[model samples]
Every structure is written in structure tokens, then in C-alpha cells.
Target: MYLLMMLSAAVVSYTATWGARYVGNRMELFSPIRSRDMHSTPVSRLGGLGIFAGFAVALLIASQSFFVKDIFRNNDAPWGILAGAAVIVAVGVADDLLDLRWWIKLIGQSAAALVVAVWGVRMTIIPFIPEPYVIDSDAVSIALTAGLIVTTMNAFNFIDGLDGLAAGVAIIGGTAFFLTAYWVHRTAILLDRSDLATLLTAVLVGACIGFLPHNWFPAKIFMGDSGAMLIGLIMASAGIVSTGQITSGLYDRANGIPTIIPILLPFAVLFLPLLDLGLAVVRRTALGRSPWSADRGHLHHKLLDIGYSHRSAVILMYLWTCVLAFGGLALAVFQWQVVMAVNLAAMTVMAGVTAWPYLRHKAPGLGPRSSAEEE
Candidate 1:
């Protein structure tokens, strides 16, 4: 059943990418080259439509299935997520076509977040709170959920600086979310898992894979704000449904530090983007600039300045994301002894690899490879 949903989304996304190749130019939806843009040439920027098409089709179809319907009946989260996604996608499309101001974009994001909250999808429980104050007030829960959605949307938006970077991260994070959520449903009997969240995550993974062929290095089309923001909302929605709908029973099941794993897994999966977002805000504010202002000081840019080629930098980040996300999953499922042993071995290997470069001889062109050289 899950495979069917993923494949359905993949097919839709693939078709959308192909169609965009021809129609995107005609629609005047190319992302213009800017001072901070990594690409020199204008590229089709509305690729998120393909992702949305694939996801919506699979979800709408699944919502009709007898088995899925049984799991999601009367669940407003699924419908609310879709509605919020639509709002974000519209904002992204408008931004891509009209170059909307930052405040305008924020307004759109806020509206979408509020819409999801109004649909009864707010985070009612504080996942890591101590036993005494586990539950939060209605106002606090709604505000935090909405804030999380908006922050995630922007986090992903800020990291869409390199070819395949945002899409790759989305795929990795979505996979982690799916695995962790599925494990929780299968293992944690006290909790009622949202089947819709699991299904949507699977579709998100499939959409990212389907879109990557066109978005990878030397890309044909960019997902633009539409795709990035849409993915952010999807990821945030998955997290909300998975961890936020907690019951007092869940608190009873979670004992001591073990309780934190469920909360930490989502943050670990999304660590890179959130980290980048935080650093960017701090860096911008420290320089007396707007936190929303764009710059070339991202981690990717630093990697390029240090010695890595564009593709190399992207691949390195991909490896880190996989490690962090899957490592978090391992912690959720495995014992502390096993996780510690594995982490120690992995750390040793990584340390050796890092030191090897310093021990090797330097050559004239052995520094950072240029773009033309990469070609």
C-alpha cells in the first residue's frame, strides 16, 4: 500500500517535471539570476507544482481507500495539511512570478499556518515537558504549531541555495520521518499513530526523488520557492501529527531519557536546515542587516571557499544529513550500548579521513576546483 502511494507520486512528479521543461519558459516563471544566486542562467522556478501534483494525487486517492479511510476517518490533520500546503504553494508561485516582498511572503506563510491550526491540527502537548506540565494551553499550542510551520518553511527556503541541496535534504529527512513514525506505530502501543502522516511522508520522499533528476547539479529546473516552501510545510506537518498529538498515556509510556528520543528524532532529521537558518539569522543580525537578507555565507559557500567542488560540497552535506538522521533513528530503535559502539566506530573512521588530507602533499591546483574544472 505504501509502495503504491510512493510510485503514484513519483509518476506524477516525473510527468510534471517533463511538462515544466517545455511550459515553464512560456509561463515566465524562471528564477532570475541574483547577486547571491549560484546559477548564472535563468531556470524554470515553478517545479514545486510537480511535487504538489504528485503528493496531492497520491493522498487524495489514498483518502478514498477503505483501509486508509478507516485510519484517517474524521482526522482533520490530513485535510488541514493539504489546505495549508495549497496556501504555501500559492505564495511560492506568486513570489516566483512577481518577486514578492519579504513581508508579503511572511503574511502568506502566517495565513497558511493559522489555517492549519484552525483545522484542529495544533500541537496540544509539549513533547519533552516534565510530568507535571506535560500538557499546554490551547493558545500556546496553536501559536507554537503555527510558528513551527512558518519557521520550517523559511528554514527550507533559506537552504535552497545549491542545486539538489534542498531536494536532497527533503528526501533524507522525509525518509527518516517515515521510518521513525512507522517504527513508533509498530512499537509504541500506547500511542495512536496517524496513518495519514506516514502516507504523506512516503509521498514526500517519492516526490523529492522524482524531482531530483531535473534539480541536481547543472540543473534543468529549480523547484524555486514553490517546491522548497511546500516541502517545508509537508515536513512540519508530518512532525506535528507524529509527535504533537500525544496523550497522557504517552507520558506514562515514556520513562526518563527514553522519552526524549521521540522528540529529538524530528529535530535531528531537520538539523542541517534549522542550523543553517539559525546561523544565518545570527550572522545577519550581527552584521546589522535584516535576518531575512540573502548572502553567500552559507555552509555550502564556506565549503566551496575552503577546498570542495560544488558537487563535492553537496555530497558531503548529503552524507552528514544521512548520518544525523539515521543515527537518530538508530537511537530510537536500538539500545544505548549498541548505539554508542556504532557511533564510536563511525567517529574513528571519520577522524582518520579528515586527518588524511592534512598528511598529503599539496599541489598548485589541488585547492578548490573551479566550476569550469568541474565541468
Candidate 2:
């Protein structure tokens, strides 16, 4: 059943990738990225629907499966997640077409988060508590859950500036969840718990892979608001479901990590996007600017400024993400200290790569700068 759903998801996603172009053509909605005003030709802005469509179809199919049964059977499982997702998709589609106010989009995102929160998924961690299981059923927990959900949703949306960047990152993050779910499923004796998270993550993976070819460098279609929001909400909620809601089913010791360490798994997988958003917010607020102010100051912008071609910059970022996701997995299996040592070495190497452009700018043999260089 899982295999069938995965296959169905891939097929549906591929068809949607092709169908998106036809839909955009029929709707006569095409425009290049805003950065590329130089190109007057209109390109499709509705490519997001392709991804959304594929994801929706795959999710619907999974809903009927035994794996998805937890979500369908649980009180907050099926309806709340689905309803929240619908809100995100609808709001994003409207924003893409009509350019909705940023606050309005936030409201939609919040609505979805609330649905997931109030119904099924919420952080039960008590403030200043040590034991993992002790929780106060109070207002603080609800507030924390809402705050976390909203922040994560926006985080995913903010780092989606590059062509294939967000799609790839989201897919990678979802793949991490799928892997964790599978890993836990194998070691633990639970069947239903793995089914829901695994199926959802697999569906997300299939959808992203199907769209990646078109969304890759020199993108044929831009995912825009609809796609970004859809991906963000799912990635965020998937984390909520997988770690906060489900990991407790596993009977493992603390294993030296924090009681809430499992929650960090998704964050590690999505370190790139979340880091980009967090840094952008800090930078903007420091300059007394709204966080939403559009600027070419993202990590991608920095990569470009330092002379990495767009494709190279993107590939390097992907490699970094792999290091974070798999490296952390290694930590979970091997030792945290060893993983840290390897991570430090890899980071040093990456830093050298990043500085190569600066080194190349240095004068050769202390001679006068070339006329072209001076110019």
C-alpha cells in the first residue's frame, strides 16, 4: 500500500509538472522573476499549482491507506491537518493571483496552524521542566505551540527566493522525516505511528522530486506564493506530527540529548531555510526595517556577490544541507562528539571554498593591477 501510494504520488506529480505549463498557457499567466525585469517575456507564475495538485492527489490517496490510518482515526489527525493545509493552499493561490497583503497571508497561515494545534499537534513541553513527560495542561503550552507553528510556516516561505532552492530544501527536509520515521519503525514495535508520518513524508518527497526537474537551475517554472506556502505548511506540520506527536511512541532512553532533541531533527534538516529566515529577520530588525522588506541580502545573494555562479551557489547549498541532515543522522547512530569534529572539518573546507573568490582578487606577484581589473 505504501509503495502504491509512493508510485501514485510520483506519477501524479510528474503529470502535474507537465499540466502546470498547459494551465498557465491557457490562463495566459506567465512572468519571469521580479529580479529579471530585463527579460520582457512573460513566464508562468502558476507553476505552484502543479506542485500543489500533485501533493493533494497523493495525500488523498494516502488518506485511505493503513499508514495514514492514525491521522484518519485520531481526533486531530485527518480533518485538522487537511483543513489547515487547505487554508494555506487557498490563501497562497489567492496571494499569487491578486497579491494579498502580507498580514492577510499571515492570518491564513495562522488559521491553518491553529487548526493543527488545537486539534492534534501541539508541544506539550512545560516551561522550565526537566522530565520529558511532565506537562502542565495550561495556556502556556497552547501559546507556545501557536507561536512555534506561525514562525516555522513563515520560515519556510522566507527562504524560497532561489529557483530550485526551496523545493529542493523542502523535499530534503521531508525526506529526513521519512527516514526518521522508517528508522523508528524498524527499531520500535509500532506500526500505525510510522504509517502516517512516513506516508506524508513520502508523498511530499514524491511531489518535490517530480517538480524538481522543471524547477532546477534555469527554472522552467516558478513555484511562487501558492507553492511556497503549501510546501512550508506541510514541512512545518510534518515536523510537528513526526517528533512532537509521534516520537513519544518509541520507548527509548534520553540518550544524552535533550528530551526534546527529536524535535530538532526537522530543524536540522531545514537548517538552511530556517537560518536564512532567522538571519534576515535579525538583519532587517537591526536596520529598523520590517522583516518583510524585499532585499537581495539573503545567503544566496551573498553567494552570488562572492562570484559563485548561480548553479554553483545552489549546489553548494544543497551539499551543505546534506551534511546537516545526514551528519546529524550519523550523530544519532555514532557519537555526537565525533559528528561535531567531522562537521567542523567540513565547515572549514566550505569556508575555504567560499573565500576562493576573495583570494582570486588578490594582486598576482604584487604587480600593478591589470587595466581590466582596475576598470
Candidate 3:
């Protein structure tokens, strides 16, 4: 299933690249709003439309394929997801063409989230839980989901600051989600329901794969608002869907953590984007500015400031993403011994380099104490 899905996604992504180029060269929906030493002249910014097409088709095929027909036929999840996705895409398309106000975009995102909530698909906390873990608020659930949707969409959007940056990160995250979802599907099959989680995983992988060629280093086209918005929506949707699959009607205490693993799956998968958003907010707040205020303080911006090429910054971030991804995967699978061993090894290497005496001495007064003093 993974093989077929990847193959189809590659084809779709390659084709989408061409489609994006055609639209950029011909339609003139939107052009590069910002550029910083990008390789291509007047870089294409709305390439996301092509990625969305491939993503949609790829997911539909992966889910409704002959082997998984029953899963598709049984539930309204797919259709409901599609409706919500359509809303996000439209909102993004408008933003791409015309600079929509942030508030307008927020409203659109909330409306889309409300669409899902109305499908009897709202997130409900585990009722009757003891203190600390007890979060019992329907309004809070709604707000969290809406905010999460908006934040995820913008997290992907805002991180599109360097060439191939957002696309590469999306692939990393999609791959992580795919692995975790597949794990959930396997556990689900052992329990009862056939593994639709894997099908969703396959679709996500295919979508990212298809988009990467056009979006990789020296990108000929960009996965503009269309692609980023769609990517965020599906990823958010996949997280929700997998959570439902994993925690349905099976609450054995031992299996609970493993089952609820997908809840944290999306956050870990897209941690770079999420982290970027957080840092952006903090930086802005520290400067007594609005969170939406733009600046060159992003991690990518910092990498560029430090003399790394755009591609290098993107690749370096990708490496960290993979490390966190696989490490988190190990944790999810209950391999604490392996995870701990790997964690220790990582800290050792980090200590060797980051704590190197010579480097630290060269940049005087830049040790733990300085950092602590700053804090």
C-alpha cells in the first residue's frame, strides 16, 4: 500500500509542479510577495493549488481503493473532512490572490472548524477523570480545535520563509504522521476495525512526495497558500481522524497511552512549524509588538543571518525534524530503553560540539551562565 501510494503521489506531485508553473506563467493569480536571494527570478508563490489537487486525488484513491472500500463506505468522516478542507482551501486561495486581513482569515478558519464540529465530530475530553487531567469544557474544546486549525494553517504558512523550507518540513511531518498512523492502524486491526489509518497515512505520504519535487531546493514553483492551507488542513484532519480510530471503544488502561499516542502525533510531526510559530510569537511579544508582526527573527532568518545558504538552513532543520520524529516514534512504541540510549547519545554529541571548550572560549562569556543570566 505504501509503495502504490508513493508511486501515485510522485506522479501527481510531478504533474502538479508543471500545473503550478502553467498557472503562474499564465493565470497571474499571485506573485512573490517577498523574496531574499531566491534562485528563481520572480519565484512562483501559488504553487499550492497543484499540490492540493494531487493531494486530494491521492487521498481519495488511497482510501477508496479496492482493498479499503469498506472503510470508505461505512463512515461520513471522509466527506465531512472534504467539506472542511474545501473551506480552508478557498480561504487560502483568496489570501493568495488578495491580501486578506488576518481577522478575515481567522473567521474563515473558524467557520471551517465549526463545519467539522457540527458533524458530531467535536472533540470531547475523557469524562470522569480525576484532577489535573480533568479538562471538562465543551466551549474549550471548540476553541482549542478552532485555534489549533488556525495555528496549524498559519504555522505552515508563516514558515514558508525560505526556499524549499516549508515543503521539506511538510514532507518530514507527513512521513512522521504516516508512521504513527500506520502503527495505530495495526493496533486497531488487532483490536477490531480494519486499518483505515494506514490508508490516510498513505495519502499524506503521497501528497507530500508529489509536491516535493517542484518544491525542493531551487524550487521552480512554490506551494503557496493553496498548498500550505491544504497541507495544514489535512494534517490536522489526519490527527483528529487517527485519534478517533485509536481510542474508539477500547479503553484498557495498558493500551490507553499507546492508543492516545496519535493525539500528540501531529504536534511532534509538525513540531518545527509549531516551534517556529511559538518563537515568532515570543519574539514579537518581547519586542512589544503584535504576534502577527513580521520580522527576520525566525529560525530560518537566524540561519540566514549566520551565513548558511537557504538550502542549508532548510536541510539542517530537516535533520532535527527527523531526529525528533524517529525519537518520538520510539517513545510511542514503548521502547524506552532504545529511546533513552539514543537520547543520551544525542546529548553527548550535542555536548561535545555545543559545549566544546575552544568554540565556547572563542565566543567568550557564552556559556550556560550567560544564557541563564539573559533568562
Top candidate by lDDT:
1
TM-score for candidate 3: 0.82
Q: After superposition, how far is residue 84 of candidate 3 from its true place, in Å?
A: 1.8
lDDT of 2 by residue, 157-186 (tens): 776766788788777767766776667666
Question: After TM-score superposition, what is the CA distance of residue 88 in candidate 2 from its true location, in Å?
Answer: 0.9
Give lDDT per model, in order: 0.79, 0.69, 0.66
- Per-residue lDDT of 196-216 in model 3, one digit per residue for the tens? 455555665676677777777
> Cα miss at 170, model 3 (Å)?
2.0
What digit string (tens of lDDT, one per residue) describes model 1 on residues 174-274? 89878877766656564345465678789999988888998999988889898999998888877776665355243233333455665577788788889
Clashing pairs in 2: 30-43, 31-43
Please identify model 2 stretches exceeding 4 Å from their true place. Answer: 1-3, 31-41, 66-71, 126-130, 133-135, 191-193, 245-255, 362-375
Candidates sorted by lDDT, best first: 1, 2, 3
Number of clashing residue pairs, candidate 2 = 2
Off by over 4 Å in 3: 35-40, 126-140, 187-193, 245-260, 347-375
Model 3 lDDT at residue 141: 69
